[model samples]
Target: MTLHCLPSTDITELPATVSNSTENPETQTTAPAEKSAWKTLSGLLPFMAPYRGRVILAGSALLVAAAATLTIPTAFRFLIDRGFSLPANVATDASASATAMADSGIAAGQVNSVFLGLFAVALILALATALRYYCVSWLGDRITADLRQAVYSQVLRQDPVFFETLRTGEVQSRLSSDTTLIQSLIGSSISLGLRNSLLFVGALGLMIWTSPHLASIIVGLLVLVVVPIMVFGRRVRKLSKDSQDKLADTGALANETLNAMSTVQSYVRENMESDRYSQATNAAFDSAIRRNRNRSYLTALAITLIFGIIVFVLWLGAQAVIDGRMSPGLLTQFMLYAALVAGSTGALAEVLGDVQRAAGATERLLELLHAQPAIASGKQSLVASSTADVAGLGARVDFNNVNFSYPSRPGEQALEELSFTIEPGQTVALVGPSGAGKTTVLQLLLRFYDPRSGSISLDNSAIDSLKLNELREAIGFVSQDSVVFSDDVYANLRYGKPDATDEEVRQAASDAQALDFIERLPDGFNTYLGEKGVRLSGGQRQRLSIARALLKNPPLLLLDEATSALDAESERKVQMALERAMSGRTTLVIAHRLATIVNADRILVMDEGRIIESGNHQELLAGNGLYAKLASMQFNAAEFHPAVEAVRVANSPC
Candidate 1:
């Protein structure tokens, strides 16, 4: 017997039609919204709000550091004039002493205190600057961790539909790369930007106080620099977003190819995948280069204009000093302030570029946070009637005139107005051709998606009203495709019933006929199942899945072609195990082979989402309907014909 591995669901495709006329067209658009840099920057405020105290403290530290830095340039003025110049009394005394002791070659003290004062100022500034750096760096790390945790928690709470539109690599990128950018902005750029901005303003203030004419020259030069930055800032933001997009595309391509390495190797398409990835990388590189070129040009232009103005203004100041209109010391202080302003402005230009790039990253992050999920939790929480009540476990599932079209395939209905009932403690087999709503039934039953215009209920309560987690807890499902995590056999088996004890787990595994094989392994139950249980054969994986369901012991067991992947011997053992487990529970089986479910209490043969035949196997075969046709095609006549004929003959009227 050949067992076919189940195919995974792909959710990237778009729907051809809209189920609701009011559905938003924007949801279908591939492009993100156009936003300004300022708008994007402002969006980060909410995430930062919770850490306002840290921000305030960091900003205060930066302000102190800036104030201290501004004082250094002014201290040079006092050092040059008062520190170098001798006191009148001392100078007179020294001249008289020098004349008196001229023959003896004696010297007198002419000490200046300005150097001592300047040294004190420098020491204070250095200490305050060091403290500010430490504080801001600490705050940066703290805020980044908080933001990352917040994003991760939000992603975890989101419904599967939210993930349908997102790729794992893209999400990982935002959490890592994007958050890192925000951290740099918060920790370093914000502090440096505020400090430099204050320095620039303070130096300008002092320059104007010292020499109004030179201050005017500096302001005019800054205005010229600002014009170009304003013009190119928006373009830089757009390019930054493009670069991030291309990079994410490259990451996603690599992730996809690696995840499907087996398929790539089987098809021998390694070179093709490599070429595709290289193309994405090249696009990212091109965008990054363009952004870098624009930044370089902006920097060079700002520097040239700023220094040219400084040079012209300094020449004017030098002539004033020569004509005795300004003291040499005062001119020195004024020139220092001008240089400070020029340096700060240059730093500001670079800060502005970083701000624009961070804005782009912030916009991408906010888009993810704001996007709504297709499914949402109900306002009211559902409570189980009683924790120990077995009656509460037995749900009366009814598909009341249900119709469903996949969200990604709206024009074509996957299920029509299909109606059926699974009575408590009855085993019902659903037999159908492919695309005949077999899997759709299981999806609906599991509440992955609500019907387009019908209601599904459990024990007279609409499933919609019940808490999703509460509703799901009462049902156990074993699909054709079982997901095995990279965990030990014991942990994987207990996944369905996390609280089950080791003894309980063993019992469940034994009931599923998986104990013998599990024991023979080197570590037995402790053996780790390498990714998706690729270490195990198809039959072993199926048995382990059965063990999981058995451990769950849910009142309603959903077996979606559970035996389809088992060989003849494994099939017999699993079928017997299932029969034993389903003795006192409600069972819904999506059957592929006719023999396995021949003894089901009731069988519903479906075609194109509608139930066309319903009865026991013998009864349905006697009626010569859809069930009979499917059974004839799947079952061997010679193997069971004589037995079936004898039963029919015994029941016939002679």
Candidate 2:
């Protein structure tokens, strides 16, 4: 079980195959028309190359087993002709047969030796077959594991743009069901194909040696059998690819529905989802049936033609025996070899279908494994600057005349002429309505997507010139929708800082005001969070996310509606903690709640992907611009007391 990784890729050039499949899976599920199904399997050679030693051993075992099998008919010929061919006229009665054998000078020892020889051949065949199975099965398991890991690693490295066209469920389907098909091809089909191929060739050669006339006739018929098999095989391969795509559709649907179970249940659309899933499953079933039907037809034709040839050849050989043109033992040997030939040929046909099906699976896996992201990272790493080395203030972000649109929506600019600088240790807030590009600003700053035009720099160096890991490491991001994995509380908090000490974790949680609830859990910090932290309240999940980002303690922090889920008291406590953390770090806050950023060093009000005003809280209100309008909507003059500093806002801004 040799291990291997996929070849290193730039992660910037999106493969055309993947892009096509991602955009329209139904039409593009099949590989390119030019690539034959069999050729597609060749893509898996790299994955198999590492285990060539195991493969060689398996092949050797297969050859030995096949040879041992072919020897059995010859052993039978000796047993029948020498040991069992007692005087034909005296064989009706046991005493007569015994007398005839004695008169004919036939030895019992000879018969015993022939039987023992046959038994020895059988034993050898069984042992070799077992060894072959183990080696091939081991290769299958090991290679499949490596291939899956490599594909997953490649997917993980892709940027957001890559995922814009590919669905999570589709990716999951390729990872699981598609890989299973490859495993079957490697473990059983290829081995079976090879062994039977050897048997077929060996049997055909012996048949020709025994009776060239009969062998020639059979060879011509086998050629006829092959033409139809090849024709039907092409159809089966096409249908097989379609079947896999439909199955993937069902998986994608099921995954989407289950992941959004809450939404579906709230809408009382359980039956609707069930119907949709049933439709997808039915489509998959129809596709599978069509593929299998074509395969069955192929099998029927091959078996009929192959065995018909065997029966015809046997008839001819039997006639030869009656005419004394051939001995009874020789005819019997020919018949046995004929059966092997027919059986092996039929098995090869079956294996061909399996190989074709697996080829489709291989093509899909290769597409994903080879796909590249559009965003390329440079070899350069961010340098630790003198100002940034001061624990929390070294990082600086600059977006100069940056304009961008998401790949999925190229016509709509997500950000336009976005230019801003967050100086080291400065706190800046971006306040805007929904779709005003507040979050897009954070995304650009994080380099999730490159701007369509202009440049983004970190610490005076173009971000594209810095390695992704280094650039991302310098910034901590807390999105509005907090993500918490299904793990223990301590592990979730430690996600951003894998090497964080226990003390550091506890303190970060404490700063985020999550420690009290964490302590109240049944297992305290060790409590399981459940999927997406379903075990906790929305606010609690948000706090855990904040704690995670805090644990990283990056020089720059971006918070997008970080405290939107928290209650007032929890929000106040967390905000105070954030202010303290921001005291010496560059912080960019995206908040709809104006009150949250009232004390920020600077505020940028944005609309339609461009900043409309820039000022502090009082200055924005005086400008009576978008920011002032938002403030007035959230805070009423009659109910609001500036001194008390009380405010109210919608959960989601328009």
Q: Compute each candidate's TM-score over C-alphas.
A: 0.85, 0.92
Best by TM-score: 2
Each prediction's RMSD to truth: 10.0, 6.9
lDDT of 1: 0.74
Please report, in order, the local distance difference test score of every candidate based on alpha carbons.
0.74, 0.81
On the 0 to 100 scale, the lDDT of residue 159 in model 1 is: 61
Q: Quote the positional error of residue 90 for candidate 1 in Å.
A: 13
Off by over 4 Å in 1: 1-33, 85-120, 379-389, 636-654
The sequence of per-residue lDDT tens digits that candidate 2 reaches over residues 1-654 is: 111011111111111111011226432323455488768888888988988999999999888888888887787787777767876567578788777777777677767877788788878887888888899999999999999999999999888877766778888878988888888788877887788888889989998987898889899888887788889998888787778877877777888899999999999999999999899778777877888788888888888888888898789888888898988888888888888887777777778888778887888889888888777887776764424645556478888999999987989988899898878888999998899999988888788888899998888888888888888888899999999999999899889999999999999999988899999999999999899999999999999999999999888899999998987788888888898778778899999777788889999998989998999887787788888788877776533533225433222233
- Clashes (N, CA, C under 3 Å) per candidate: 0, 2
- Give the per-residue Cα lDDT of candidate 1 at 97: 47
Candidate 1 lDDT over 388-440, as tens digits, reads: 22653345678899999987678998888888887777888999898888888
